[model samples]
Target: MSDRNDIDPFYDDRSDPVRVLVVDEAERGERLATGLEAETDRIAADTVPTVDAALEAVDRRPIECLVSTVHGPDGTGDELLAAIRDRYPAIPVVLVVPDEERAREAIDSGASDVVVAESVSERCFVLANRITTAADRYRADRRADRQRRRFREVTDAVPDCLWIVDPEWSELSFVSGYERIWDRTAAELTGTPEDFLNAVHPDDRERVRAAMDRLSDGTSVDLEYRIRRDDDLAWVRTRGEPIVDDGSVVRLVVLTRDVTDRKERERTLSALHSAAREIGSADEPAAVYETLIRTADRVLEFDYVAVDIKRDGYLVQEASTLDLKDGGYYERTSLENDDTFAVRSYKRQETILVDDLREFDVTPADPDYRSALTVPIGEFGTFQTGASEVGAFDRDDREFAELLVGHARVKLAQLQDKRVLRERTEQLERQNDRLDEFVRVVSHDLRNPVNVAKGHLSIAREQYDDDSLEATMEALERIETLIEDLLTLAREGEEIDDLEPVDLATLVPECWRYIDTKDAALEVETDRTIAADRNRLRQLLENLIGNAIEHGGSDVTITVGDLPEENGFYVADDGTGFANGEREKVFDPGYSTGVDGTGLGLDIVRRIADAHGWDVRATESDAGGARFEIVGVE
Candidate 1:
């Protein structure tokens, strides 16, 4: 015998060698030894003279293939083959039998191959090749089984669906974990590659098909589309990667995920932003409702929207998505009518969300509309939307509706307030016009009679008591002064609409020329040009200058200058200033410190400043006299 270390030159060490068990009597074993040893390059042989030895040899170490004689010392070869099949079913068996009858029996007994005794001498190489090939095939199958088990474990743990298709797309090559996601078995979806495309929504079918057409190269595929299985619909993101081998496309593997929640949220946010921008810029309440209708129809997918304003214990329709021909039908129908749902929401001061409009007592404007959402705008009204599909209004829709309604309520209130202010301003202007006319008439009608009385008393002074005539003339002079002050007050009360750039330096001197300064000196300090109503500003300056001259001595210096930081202008006099606790009351009409003074002058100054949107303040001047500062000049 050769040493165990001697390797045959014909053996391919890279291939797995078969370990074979030869079970027979000693004579037969020795007879077959020569043929088995000839192929020792690929087969390792162990001789056993009996079935018991064969069983012991198999248990001691794994046997890849078995070669047995028809009859062994302890049992028949078929018996030994049966024993190994029961215990190590994966091991292949080859029978070396004496005759054709036993060969048939061995063939029926599940042997891997059968060799007749006569043909064994000439077919030794072929027999050994079969044994080696069987062993290689078994090992490959075992490795594939292990890999499949590991793949199943990994795919079962994730939420994604994994599948593979051949490059030709004739059929699916591999599919895993799809049963859990789509509630379908692998066998059900494996034959047709079009099964995947068929499951996609009709709108996305062409996109998916186009993506598949681009899968010829070893490129990746990513797509988002909608899918439907029976009545269930969802947004799915599918990504595919090609399996390449030697720069050739082998197959495409794909993963699909459900992204419905993410897509819905994104759409809702976009709708809300669009609605807010459109509604906020609308100028009137009607325009706001119109914008809401268009935005909700385009983005929120609402088929109808209505705006109702509460008036006289009834909700009146102000705006709607519906276009009425006569327009009186909508306006004539109030929320108190039996078929309106807005009244319910308004009465409860809460939102009403109905999946099916049939549940409500009232009939919807459109019979196709099933989903309804109504939000109350405090006591003002209700804004409602209706959709054609049942359960279309989800929690996201409800939240968006509430936000839009809240913003619309604020804009409507602002519009109403603006309208009220405009009407009130017009009414006050009419009243002022009437008052101005009355003052002009009184000044014209009463001033001439008093002047005539003064003249008549003067003429009578020579013919009557001098004391009585002097008293009569003094009364007439007081009446003339009162009439002039009243006329000035009434005229100044009118609005100042047109303003021009008036230089204070030029205006103050002009006003000084009109005032009786007596002996007061005028000091001009400012040259700033301010935007003002020229005539109204002249009146303001005249009043301040006259007030200063009346209180200050004839030699008192009246200073006119700009305030610091362009706040406005200041008029101050170098005279004995106001006493304590008199500044706040200085502008009151008919409140005068001098017995001969008319107190309407300072009040008219305040009115003119207010008309120009300026603020006036009374304070002490630098020369210990009164100061009037007009701030907020433009």
Candidate 2:
């Protein structure tokens, strides 16, 4: 493995003591300070009763950071955040708010980051790491954008989607995945891609047509639309880039993508999250279990449901609502049969599903059964597939038992916390174990192919000196980097960073040098700074610049400037800005414009920005390439 230490992750050392001013009333201040000190030896929290005292202490000593209550005896953490932003911008600050409202306030007041006091250690540490990473990345991207801005025009022009439409909207040019996406030849849509957009859903076409015309009129716009195709509507995301001679737009060049799956996943996860949070807060376990069952049934498209708790080898069916249930549901209870579903789940500590239990003896005494799901209830539950299980994902008496089992393991963890304090501790430990195992599994499984491919490619490149061979090797290495990124995201913990003022104009250029793009042209210029994670800022730059070089063409130029509406930094390139239908899908994992990328770069950029409380998005660049603007830079 290449040593990242050689890369100089910006901060020479993060081990320096976290100089913190903990503001609170006398008793709570000292007690929480003591707890924080005990939580980490690296933290040196000095207790203070008032915001004035905290400010004085910050001035007295070079306070590296601040960790205080949202509302102390004297003032709130926002007061401290504003004070620090205005006065001691060098020092990072994090607020230890009790709930979401205070966290929101901290975010609004320019506090670096915020964590709930309930989850301080896990959340705060994560925040701190992210804050530092964001600061570094922001610096790197600025540098990279500057370097990319000096390149020639071919790199910018060739990779473009290059759509040109006349005043009547007849297409003149289109390139990059046009035929494969529309399933029609670009020659077929020459000067009339918008006419072909007759397939656009009525409700979306006006906005879509308006955005297209706006871009054609020299004003760039990014839009999402539902295109009517065949007999159905397909979602398309497009970012428009205009070719202008004067103030008027003569032609529109747009990049597009089908974001159907990503949007669906986002919606599903949102619904699941809301349901989970609401159910989790219920005063009764039965209500929580009921909420899970109904939500799972409706959202995930499950057929049947049965929740049971086993004690002393007896079945305590806590919740039972079959998706196909009628009045006679319990009359066919073969679940507790001697050789039945519940019997297997309890005996083997696994979930059992019988797709067709009619084959079994329903002899009243024997109890007949069919498609059934029985899951174990325990904090340490592991819903292993039974050896006697049938097919996987088949209509047959398959391991559908494991489906409910899998989700039940998660639900079981949730239920475990409500048992008792001692049981709650055990459940927490078990949950931690599961999370650790998940992280390890994802890392190891992902890294195996990535490392193997890179290692073998390195060996191949050495053996074959051909340019084509070298090019292949380089692509392989990029894939490996992408895989490694997946592991990085999984490993990232939750925490807020101490807020610090960062100079992006200086840092963005520095990170650009790390890329071995000597053969590719480089130009960079920027004069903007903001509040962000230093490292993530650089990653965002690297991803965006890398994207330009790869897709916008090998030679590109990067320019960095500021946004007026929001104190933000812009990294613009002269590359394929964004293709029609791809403006948003480009952010999805494994989604890439180029055939070579593993598609994790922009994702890392966006996610790191998310963790740091910023927005990184793609837009039309002044250089006629892709533009990535980190908004809310301050």
Candidate 3:
């Protein structure tokens, strides 16, 4: 017996030695086993006396190779070989036969190799070599099997479909993840690689076919197209890469992903953007409501859509896709009732989604609707959508509906602002009409009485030189001055009719001549020509000049100059400036600091500036006097 520590010269160190079971009568089995082990340590030989023992030894542990004689004590070597091959197909079996004919017969019956008993001693090395070769081959086969299984596991776990096809696309060599994306098992596409095209949407079939052709021609392709899964269409993005061999295309690998959700979101955003533009352009609330209903219908494809405006404590249906009934074009629901989805959403000021109206405790406004999604358009109204199918609305549907309602809300708020502005404008026009009537009455009625009093005072002066009569004349003259100031205030409040370029250099001196300046000095520091109503400009200059003389005493110097930086002009006086905080009050109609001052002078100046679309502000001049600057000329 060889010691366990003895290393055989023929054994390879790279791999473990092959274990072989030898079956025969006691003497031949032992002799053959010893001879095989003596030739190489790579083959570990064990002796068994019968076929049953050989089968038992093979099953007891890992046996890489089996060596058995043609006949044994209990059964033929063929029986052992058959059993080992049937149970452990990966284990190699080598048969030792009595003659050449028997060796040929053993080889035909699934034997790895055959050795003749007559040449046993001479061919011992050959037998050892064959055993080691068979074991190495078996290990390689096992490694390949494991690699294939791992590949399948990894590919099957991915969410996208992976497939490998020949250059012609006639053979589908490998496929995985097809069941999930295609809604069909991989077996259905095994023999027919082109059958996937049948699932492509009819409109996209030609384009997909062209992409496949490009892949066959050694060109890579990335494509997004729609495919039909049952009755619904799904968007899929596919990338195909050509596998080239020696500069020629051999196969093509394709990866496909289901992108239906991504495509739907993009579509929703595009539709909403277009809807916003249309809704914003609508000038009236009714037009905005109609556009909202139409856009909601086009985007969601819902069975019914309604827009309700909150008016007079009711949700008045302003627009709807439902047919009008009960001799009215719309319906109204009381907002106090929380049973309806629209009212509930309006009160909460948020979005409400009901998958099934029947399951919810609240009653749907439309009994025919089984699902509903309602969104509030701020305090203005509620926008609602409904469908006849239960559970028809999903998270995506609710989000899309909310987006449309948000756009509608913005346009509604704009419409509301426009309405308020129109109403205020009309109210101001009515007040202006009454002011014109008051101005007319003061011009004719009041001036006549003052004129008659002056005439009576003149007769009294002629009859008797009385001091009381002189006082009466002064009082009547004051009344006439007050009437003239009132008329100027009323007339100047209107918009400037026609604008002609007026030179302040000429107009200023002319206005100073009209004002009763006892000893006041005037400086026309500006020579600029500005567009203005000629008559209105004269009135403005006269009032400002008279105000300066009255407030600044008789010897005040008034300066009129262009504010180049301000793009307008300023009227300043070298007199006692306004008291602290009196600049702001000077423009008020009835604000007067002097007892005899009518206080309408500065007020009229502000109105004329406004009619010309100019901004006016009062500040102290450089000489500690009042400065009124009118900017924003153009």
How does each model score on lDDT? 0.79, 0.60, 0.83
Model 3 lDDT per residue over 481-585, tens place:
889888988877788768899888999999888779999898889989998888888887888888888898889999999999979988899999999889879
Error of 1 at 33 (Å): 26
lDDT of 2 by residue, 1-634 (tens): 1122224334343455555667667787787667666766666778887778877887776555666666444556667777778876655677777788877877888776677766444455554553444344434443454444423233244432334455457646435555444556666664554555666788877777777666655787887778765676667677767777776666666667777666756666666666757665666566756665665555444444445555444554455554324532332233345554555656676555545455655321212223444555543322212112232234322323343334545555655655676787898789878877876766687668767877887788788788987777777666567657766554433333766667766776676788755445655455555666566567667777777778776667667677868767777777667778778787787788677677777777778778777777777877667788877756
Q: What is the lDDT of residue 521 in candidate 1?
A: 93
Which residue pairs in candidate 3 collide?
A: none
* Candidates arranged by TM-score, highest first: 3, 1, 2
Maximum-TM-score candidate = 3
Per-residue error (Å), model 3, residue 428: 4.1
Model 1 poorest 10 in a row by lDDT:
1-10
Give stretches of model 3 more than 4 Å off. Answer: 1-88, 91-136, 139-143, 166-170, 189-194, 197-226, 235-256, 324-330, 358-360, 366-370, 388-390, 428-464, 487-586, 605-634
Model 2 Cα displacement at 262 (Å)?
A: 1.9
Q: How far is candidate 2 from the true structure (C-alpha RMSD, Å)?
A: 49.2
Candidate 2: segments with Cα more than 4 A from true spot: 1-167, 179-196, 229-233, 246-248, 305-634
Q: Judged by lDDT against the true structure, how good is candidate 2?
A: 0.60
